[model samples]
Target: MNEAIERSNPEFPPKIINGCVWKLREKSPGMVNKPSRGVFQLLKYRN
Candidate 1:
């Protein structure tokens, strides 16, 4: 994950995911596991 992010944007900090609210799920593969609360969330990034 860090490698991909760095490849795309070298200036991107490694700490970006540190304080972020994220989850890992076995069924969803490489997706963020949190549920969307409303319509606005549907357009948000999933993986």
Candidate 2:
């Protein structure tokens, strides 16, 4: 994820990946093991 973000814009680094889910269950769809960062979050970027 960091690699992709870096490739997108090296100079402009407003976007960042805070947390991620390691795995998920097959029974539950669209559901992660636990809460993840950057999800359902909206914040203003500072200069």
Candidate 3:
């Protein structure tokens, strides 16, 4: 999921930080700032 977004937008963060991943949504006309969205996941990484 993260990989797909990253592939589409290089600016996307690779992994969640502090249990959350922040992203900017597309801006519309008359919008003062871009909306931000967060994806939280308790991911277990295996090495």
- Give me the candidate number with maximum lDDT: 1
Worst 10 residues of 2 by lDDT: 38-47
Span of ten consecutive residues with least summed lDDT in model 1: 35-44
Clash totals, every prediction: 0, 0, 0
Q: Top TM-score: which candidate number?
A: 1
Return the candidate ranking by TM-score, descending: 1, 3, 2
Better of 2 and 3 by lDDT: 3
Off by over 4 Å in 3: 16-47
Which 10-residue window of candidate 3 scores lowest in summed lDDT? Answer: 38-47
- lDDT tens digits, residue span 1-47, model 3: 45566678787556652223333223222332323244323223211
Q: Candidate 2, residues 1-47: lDDT per residue as tens digits?
A: 45665678687443433222222223344442323542321223211
Query: What are the models' TM-scores?
Result: 0.33, 0.26, 0.28
lDDT of 3 at 16: 50
- Report lDDT (CA) for all predictions: 0.43, 0.38, 0.40
Identify the runs in model 2 with alpha carbons over 4 angstroms from their true place: 12-47
TM-score, cand. 3 vs. native:
0.28
